[model samples]
Target: MRQYWINFKGNQEGPMSLEQLAQKGLDETAYVWHSGLADWVKITTVPELNDMLNNSAKAAQESPAELPEQEPEAVTEEVPELETEEVPELPQEEAIADEVPSLDNVIESPAPNYGGQQQYAMPVAPQQGPAPQEAPKCPPTNLVWSIIATVLCCSIPGIVGIVFAFLTKKYYREGNLEKAQRMSDYGAWSVIISIMLGIISMPLSCAMNIFKVAM
Candidate 1:
């Protein structure tokens, strides 16, 4: 009977007999055959066996020494060179050093205007502006709606809405318009749901009220 070393779900569990391994969902393809260890070695999940085989095959193909034969080296004979003519030399001038031009003497030409209009010299912009920046606009407050929602949220659903509304208010005060809007939406939806549930329960509550009235 064949022996196998099973590696399953990141755990190295067994060196069980092949029959035992098979009972645990092990198969010939699931594990690699290792002649040196005289056992089948499992690497990954059973379904990944084909991928492992392809990877192994690719690794074997990429190995260097398995390449084909080279062509024979060619022999070449050296040829002799012919003699060339000599060239004549020209005379060089002696250096006369003159005083360098002063910064004031150095003239700069005005930049040519590519456009038809005469180009006005551009003034450097100030690094800091004196203008006072306008403060960011505050989000619109729905105080009445907020109070109504908060009162309705006395129950579980209403409480959730009130929590969201509080969060929205806090974010709005902090100048986080986006987060405030999101929280407000949550509060609004929760308030609507809670109101709907309360309205639905009113009929049953009214029946109980009628029974008490009759008694």
Candidate 2:
């Protein structure tokens, strides 16, 4: 019923109802004039125009805007199934029962008689473990001679002779025949050396005793 005039694009558009002005997309900043207005004024200053603009803004906010439609997604391709393989069956075996012999099939051997003594097959003397390693055929340690030398001659070479004699016995026991023989020779030599030293020192010792007696 009430008519309003709008300054549309710096030109007087005019004489339209509030619905026409709202449809025209005018805002509060738009200049408008009407019969009761003194000169051109903003739409925000007029109660009727301002109220219409607010109501229109509220209605626009309440409604949703339309969106552009999207294209449908591409159809997926199906995968082909693989071929199945056939397995060969195994052959079955027939079960066999154990065969036992009767007493008629068995042959008995006659036992040997030894003057009625029930001889148990003398347990084959546990194969005598390689004949006890036959004590290595080595030379005798000259221990007695070494001891004799130690007691009757110079102590130094005599003691060495005794040591060699013991080493000969030790090497012989350890299965070292060559070392045992060598130590035996060493013992003999040491004994000989001791006897020779004792012989050489005897006259000197006697002469010294004689000299002391004379002095």
Candidate 3:
């Protein structure tokens, strides 16, 4: 029997009988040569190595090197919480003010009432009780005019105008309409008198100054 030899790991690993080579288990793609063979051939081609090749292939299939499939990395998601906003309550007084009717709402009457008779043609005014007396309108104290009169005209009437102006506002606030009106008239008269005096005195004052300068 010719002894078989095989190369492994880049060197001659065996020079044994075929039976011994088979027992040792040849690689599936191992190269083998013998005294009769022309060149090295696959160990599997040899009938003797077939059992070893089958056993190796079965072992490899049973214990594969690939890692077990990983369950798709557990996907974890964080859901954010939403915040709630609160509305503030309005005060009773302000709420009541909003509910109150507007002043301009009471007095407006757009269309006149129509009647067939000429005598009834005049629109009857809405019935209402005698209206409360309106507060009196105060006249200006003529303070500006009073100051002008005092500076450029006679001082006596200007001072009186300013005094009457002050009295006009005071009497009106006190509900003394007659007195307030009287004060208003007097104030105007005082300012007029002061202006007339100032005009008349202006020429006299200039003339007197000129006469003194000549002297």
TM-score (all chains, Cα) for each model? 0.30, 0.37, 0.37
Off by over 4 Å in 1: 1-143, 149-154, 211-215
| Weakest ten-residue segment in model 2 by summed lDDT | 87-96
Give the alpha carbon lDDT tens digit for every residue of 1-215 in model 3.
33556643233444576446646655653545443222333455444344445545565566554312211111111011011111111221232235422312222322222222322211112112111112124666777888887777788998888889888877765545568789989989998998887778889999999999999
Candidate 2 residue lDDT tens string, 15-78: 6766578689876546565443223444565555555676667666664432111101100100
Whole-model Cα lDDT of every candidate shown, in order = 0.39, 0.53, 0.50
Q: How much lDDT does candidate 2 score?
A: 0.53
Cα misplacement distance, residue 145 of candidate 2 (Å): 1.1
Residue pairs of candidate 3 with colliding backbone atoms: 141-165, 153-198
- List, residue by residue over 1-215, the lDDT tens digit for candidate 1: 22234443222334454335434543222333211221222323222233334334544567554322110110010011011101000000000012212211111222122221211211111002110110223333444454565575336767777678678767755545567788878777777777777788788789999999999
